[model samples]
Target chain A: MKAVVTVTGTDRKGIIAQVSAFLSEKNINILDISQTIMRDRFAMIMVVDASECTEDLASLASSAAEMGKDIGMSVRVQHEDIFQAMHRV
Target chain B: MFNSTEVIETIDMIEKEHLDIRTVTMGISLLPCVRESAEQTAQAVYERVVRSAERLVPTVGQLSREYGIPIVNKRVSVTPVSLVTAAFPEQSPLVARALDRAADALGIDFLGGYSALVHKATADYEQKFLATIPEALAVTQKLCASVNVGSSRSGINMDAVRQMGGIVKQTAESTQGGMGCARLVAFCNAVEDNPFMAGAFHGVGEADRVINVGVSGPGVVQHALSFAPEADLTEAAEIIKRTAFKITRAGQLVAKEAARRLGVPFGVVDLSLAPTPARGDSVAHILEELGLEVVGGHGTTAALAMLNDAVKKGGVMASSRVGGLSGAFIPVSEDIGMIEAAERGAVTIDKLEAMTCVCSVGLDMIALPGDTPASTISAILADEAAIGMVNNKTTAVRVIPAPGKKVGDTVDFGGLLGRAPVMPVHCGSAEKFISRGGILPAPIHSFKN
Candidate 1:
């Protein structure tokens, strides 16, 4: 299974380092990363292989959201299937 | 990898738009639970529900966690109690209490099917059972009840309709804060596989066990329409169809997941855009967004008719089965925009009746003045039943005639049931018509055989 993690906030230091460290601690491999800055606001999205992750998907989602609060960024983790099911036929 | 836009859209729909699965209801058969005595039958009913739904709440939570979609409610609908307790209608409260206790024990949100199908006529024991409904509902917190008093095939039972008029009033007065009335529903052409409540029941035609999912996403549909400001009505309808397709597909996935894990058959994905008290999650707001100045305004019915049809057209293909009342619901108290419209004198009962001829439900969650007579309530039911009978659709009435309150005052049900202004009713009496106790004949079109 795979999941999408979204991070958005003002451009700050160590955003990637903090998020990647949290993911690695849970044994989740980041399959892809895309980051962009628009109008001075930083945004990054990560596709992670969650099949081997130690934490349950729901708790992982809540933990990622909590980590964002700690780092002053807004984060959300959602199952990849929801995106595919809604956007595709 | 899914695009950044897609991830953001899903997250925003949940956090900002209140997108969540309204309910994943389990329909359990109580036919096997009927026993020799009323007490033993009640006991079996409790045990059956408890055993069948022991893992319902936890299983739904696990599935929600795995899928990352918030499932709002876990409910159970059983065989109508009238059938189960036909031998001992006077002692039906025992069954109601047992069901109530089981729901509380399992932590289920609401349990329906404390119901009777008296569309054509009531039997001897059924009448005794109908008389017990007020007390049964007044005493139980989670037990929701409904009665089907008319159908396209059978026509309206004016006798049952008249009795329910008084029963609804008694149910309100006996309960605390008049909330019992909020949980009672009267229906025409009630479907056998609805997952929504105060109206859901496991019809005899259903399997021994099945999972029915009622998917809700008025916010998602409304948001999709917001981006197409430059589109014409035809284009707008297309947008709604596409959005409903997505919503029903999501429901289909969840329904399959839950049924697989629970070892039950997936019944249907009820493609109803049921709204809540939340700001953006309103069917009326969607209608208002479609260029209607107010929900009860002139074009409101046309816009709603298009929306309801577009939803079915888009959703019908997404699910293998779609049997519930699959259309947009305009429950007044449950939609903030609707509440404001009614409070500001922008909407009226007459307009709501006109709209129900096209929408999925009829005058749902509406509040009427306390002084309104019981016969008037029955008249409202007859009029709404007439619409469903002629059109061959499902329509229901769940009006709360607030006690000791008059027009313009609001009664707060709190939570998802929301608050509603006591909309005025016509002072003129329909007593003569309602007093004539007999069946309203089925429409000529219904004679097709």
Candidate 2:
């Protein structure tokens, strides 16, 4: 299933590296990723296709949560349709 | 890496400078759902609105979160209820109730368009709808109402004006002296594409489905003004124009993306400098940036007129569909620059009135001295309504007569509405003129051959 992941929290060192490494290890292909720093908070919206992933959606979410815990942030995984409905237009 | 001081200053300016979007309104016109029966019509209206707006609140919240730009209000403006009211006079109140229910169900802040555009004379259904405005507003929770009684092209509708004068008084009294005024605004030359509430409504000619965006950034404009003090007139104009362009571009981007995601046609982007309680992002600061020590000076009106025009010119070029009252606002209490000007004797009621002649919305967010009689307030509203009627543009009055505030006393309405130092009113004999309370005759152009 195509999934979109949004990561938002305080800006810190190694955030991009940590998140990218995790995604790569899981074999999740990133379709698009955009990030910007607004006022001091860091926000990133990434569209990914997880059809080829070794793990299920639940495991991917759990792993993201673990990564979020390591970096003091919040991570959410949503279906592509929900993401579009919520973020697109 | 950015310097800490620079970051702090930027943040400080945003906090103090008034950095915020005034509104993010979702335009949903309700004409396509018209049906033979009132029940069918209401059902169609409800279903279409629920389906279209079901995701509006969440989408707006997500955008607000994603951008970290505060979106102050999330509102909806649909087709005027009067058009549909013609089908069932007895069932119009139910329609109003249904709209309120939809607004509640969808979590939209307010739903406008319990309206009638009686610029000349009212039809039978129009009169019925107009009579029901007060009850409709009084009963509904989130439904805002407006009446457009005159337009510059059509001239003032003296009959409607006289009726509205009585209606305003009655509506205020019906709400137990509360004015419920926040929920209703009497406008002249009302615009169809406005996304602001208390005065927003979808026009009859709009597409069945469209998404218009009202993007506001008073703080960003105020920041641009910091560079304005030393700049020449041309330079100052360019600076404001460029800043407004960027702000409008951001709105355009959001609207395009939002429409694409929602599977709806993208509508216009309303580029108005809507203000909040914040400090640096004030419409008054933009005026101040134009070399005024304070707003409401001799040049203030001219400066605001230029700024308002320049914003429209730049915004229109940027987007294909630019509508609404797309210009700078000069609400006294809501803008810090204006409040400061009023406090310092740089701004006055009359100057603000004159400024409204050229600005986008008229007589917005003003605070009158408590002792200022109701007659005077009515007179002020009358004068403003006349200007809109003559100009054939949208203008409104949202004045708060603080019970205890005297001239020079500062009253803080807390957030959004902001604070204002009581500005002086000309202590003159408008009393006799206003007390006459007769309809000012409609202008010559009102008669169509």
Number of the top candidate by DockQ? Answer: 1
True contacts kept of each: 0.59, 0.00
The C-alpha local distance difference test score for the whole of candidate 2 amounts to: 0.72
Model 1 interface CAPRI class = medium
lDDT (Cα, tens digit) per residue for candidate 2, span B1-449? 22323333333333455444566666777878779988888888888788888887777666554433456677788888888768775577777888899999998888988888887677788877777776776677788888887676666555565556555555554553333555777788888878886788988877676777876776776676675567777777776676667567657766776677677778788888887556666778777767777778789888888888878866666666788888887777777778777778877788888998999988876666666665666667778888876666678876656555677777676566677776766676565666564346656765666
Clash pairs detected, candidate 1? none
TM-score of chain B of each: 0.99, 0.84
List runs of model 2 lying over 4 Å from the truth: A1-89, B1-22, B32-44, B63-70, B87-92, B176-179, B343-346, B369-378, B401-414, B419-449
Scored by lDDT, the top model is 1
Indicate the residue-level lDDT of B261 in model 2.
68
User: For candidate 1, what TM-score does chain B get against the true chain B?
Assistant: 0.99
Candidate models: Cα lDDT each: 0.90, 0.72
